[model samples]
Target chain A: MKPIGLKDLFVIFLKAGLAFGGGLGILAVLEEEFVTKRQALTREEFLTDYALGRIVPSGTMSALAADFGARFGGFPGSVIALTAMVLPAFTLSVSLSAAYVYLAGTPVLALLPLTILPAALAFIVAAALRLGRDITIPSVEALLAAAAFIGSLVFRISPALLLVGGGIVSMVILAFTERAENPA
Target chain B: MNPLQVALTIMVLNILTFGNGPALVPLLEERFVTMEGILTVDQLLYAFAIARVMPGPANAYVASVGFFLNGLLGAALAMVAIQLPAYLMLPLLRLHERFSDVAGVKRFTRGLTATSVGLIFASTVSIGRNAITSLTAAIVFVLALVMAYLLKWNPLLSLALAALAGLALHAAAPSL
Candidate 1:
């Protein structure tokens, strides 16, 4: 695939910005769009960018978009991607916030969110399932997931702590597994 | 709701979240309500609920909360502050190229990625407890799961159907 230009970056991120509901949940779709469809970024490039996004000190979606934009269009591309990535949600959020404040008093308005809630809930659940099938292949990866779920669910542990802990735990496991294999 | 305070507070919240938006909703609610008293708990939850209906990540809800606190300017400021970190850290992508291929980093990210997926699952449970209250709600949950995951329907459309179901359910069981 040829190197992507600023226009491509803007259009791609804008489409993503309009499509994703879950924050990190959009990574899979992004891989599909950029890697499989556009052939702009290879799977390896996307994975590296995604890992960088996870370790970076911002939102994963924003970090990934910024990195991809930088890759395609340098600093200006990053700016365009970030702006396009945010425009749709920002518009929707501000509009909804304003509307809710003015018009959410009626009984019908009250039930609107209640009705949307279940579907939204299920949406995330399905996303988790989809991501699970894609990422959690190894037993250790599965263990990390189970630990994360139980820790967050039962102990009220924060997700940040769980993610950090899982990283450390997986690192330790990898070290041990490698050592065991190379015991010469 | 001072704009500066709003900006600074949201900036700090984004930093604390470390880019994981959904995980911080409960914390966001507590602080917005109890610490600042800018919004009621119900109001905060409603803001989060409707956030799902929007296209961006759920964190875009922060913009809505900003609006709830102040208005358009507040929303704009909060959005910038929350998103600033990512752009600010763009230089780190260069550093990532140097170390991303290291074995331990690879292993650690494998863990983090899997764990992140679990966090998404937990988020569903958290939201499900609120949304799936009755048999009707359960049906919506199941129906949405099938439509979204198996049949590949647009999520917005599924949510629309759920809203109609909500209205119908309300009409049928007025006391509920």
Candidate 2:
């Protein structure tokens, strides 16, 4: 690809942002537009960055931009990628937030929680399942998920503790798995 | 009611957690819903649902909370606080390749990934308990899930269907 400007970068992520709601299956679009068409990043690089993004706070989209943006255009590139990533969605969120605040106390809007809440949970479940299918491959991770669930829901363990302890356990497991595989 | 506090809360939460915001919804409930009574569980979940339907990072929901507490300025401040840190950290992320093989980094990263999965599942349970009550609601949830998982419909489309189902159900059985 020729030298890509921040304007083009912004447009690319703006299109991705538009897909976020119902168009959440945006990887294909991204693959076609950025990877194949624009030659922005190779497929392998995008996939690796996406996986790395999962372990970060912002999740896949922003992570992709942050990771590759630095490589592609240095610090300025990363800034543009991150800003473009949020612009469209942030605008939508602002409007939705305003409407939510305005309609908060009305009788009719009260029904929104009763109705939309379930849908929200359902969406979370769906998104989780999609991601979980990837995480559960190691069976041990599934156990961790189960353990975490019990600890949080039944035992009421502190979220911070569970996360920290779980991370420690996983680290131990990774070390053992590595040693077993390589015998080093 | 304090915009600064809300901004600070978002920044702290984002800084502390290693994954999506949904995974840590319980902490949010403790702080905003129960302790402060800033918003009821229903309102909070509803706002979260709105955030879901919108396109963006999960942290954008902080703006929704800010909007509830103050207004547009609150939303802007909250968003800036949560996101500024991530941007600042980008440089570290870029430089981390030098330490990629360090045992401590490997352990921290892998461990956090597993823990994040568990935390996310836990949040699902917590949110589900609050969201599901009536049979109608349960049905809507399952339908939405099927729509998302099976049909692979757009989230906006599935959510639109769900909103319609909610309205219809409400019209049919007001008590439910």
Candidate 3:
């Protein structure tokens, strides 16, 4: 494998950031450009790439960019796509961070938090609901979720315990189900 | 502390943990609570509230907290540090299809997802405990929950309504 240099990394990051900050709509445009017009990959390939990206750690868009880049131009392509995805957001975040400090302690600053907190809570609740809808929880799974919720809320159980317990239960259930289905 | 070191630490934290961003909160609190001294627990709660209200990613609030500490430089450092690792790691993953498809890796991810949900749940309880002081606040919480779960109302809109209700209640009973 060719060694990636500092200059190459920087260029890739810069390009990915720019593309990412351009927003999801722009991503759709890029998909059409590269996947459709360029015939780099088919729609099924693109969808699989994106699904894998979402299922894996990190942001879905960044993952997709990396997958596409790797496919198109090997390591260099992956670097370019990742850079394009992140650069825009990175630049904006840096600029905003600088401006935000200057504006601190103002009434606007106070108001900003006031508006943001409720929205954030709402987002959290919505996310939980969305996740719940997606997963096919058996009665045991539902019981586990309820137990975790109650343990966290009522008994002050550590979140770590709930997570570990859930994992163990799921693994055991999966193992038993697999064994039962394929009994010799 | 060197600005670059600070940035790197945040970047590393973001990468090591899953991408939920807020996952770094407890760890960040443990690290910076003493060194920075600018963010009191109360202020941290307030900042968290503000981040929640905002339309964008919850981790974006790190900028607000960083700004509170060492001004623009701090905020810039914090944002870069938090996001940089993810930016760097995503591309790296593309090259190793086998690495991505490993069974152990999938199990680890599934475990992480479960942990993240639990953490979020814990955070909700903590946040709710802090914010829901009065009868009106409790009402707002229940309403928000119903709207989110049952009515399927958009979260941002529900939040806006809750904020409006809070503001209106505060105005009506200034003494309370």
Top DockQ hit:
2
- Candidate 3, residues A60-161, lDDT tens digits: the string is 555565555655556777656555544454444545545555676886555433333444454555555554554456544555656666776677665545
Residue-pair clashes per prediction, in order, are: 0, 4, 26
lDDT of each: 0.72, 0.69, 0.53
Sort candidate 2 into its docking category.
medium
**lDDT per residue, candidate 2, A1-184, as tens digits?**
7877767766766676566543233455567777888897888767765655555554455566666556667788777877776776667777876776678579867777556778888876776676566675556677777787788778888767777787788778878887898994
* Model 1 fnat value: 0.67
- The candidate scoring highest on TM-score is 2
Q: Write the per-residue lDDT of candidate 2 for residues B19-71, one digit (tens) a residue.
A: 36565465566568756888776766766777676766665676777777778
lDDT of 1 by residue, B1-176 (tens): 69879888788766655655554554464457645777764456556656666776657778878888888998888888777788754667666656546688677777776887777676566556655667766766787778778887776787777667766877788556
User: In angstroms, how far off is A48's CA in candidate 1?
Assistant: 6.1
Winner by TM-score between candidate 3 and candidate 1:
1
Model 2 misses residue B23 by how many Å? 2.2
Q: Where does candidate 3 chain A have its weakest 10-residue lDDT segment?
A: A17-26
**Interface RMSD score of each model:** 3.6, 3.1, 5.1
Considering TM-score, where higher is better, how would the candidates rank from best to worst?
2, 1, 3
- What TM-score would chain A of each candidate receive against the reference chain A? 0.63, 0.79, 0.66
Question: Which parts of model 3 are misplaced by more than 4 Å?
Answer: A1-33, A36-39, A69-115, A135-184, B1-9, B21-104, B134-159
Model 2, A160: alpha-carbon shift in Å?
A: 2.2
Error of 1 at B113 (Å): 3.2
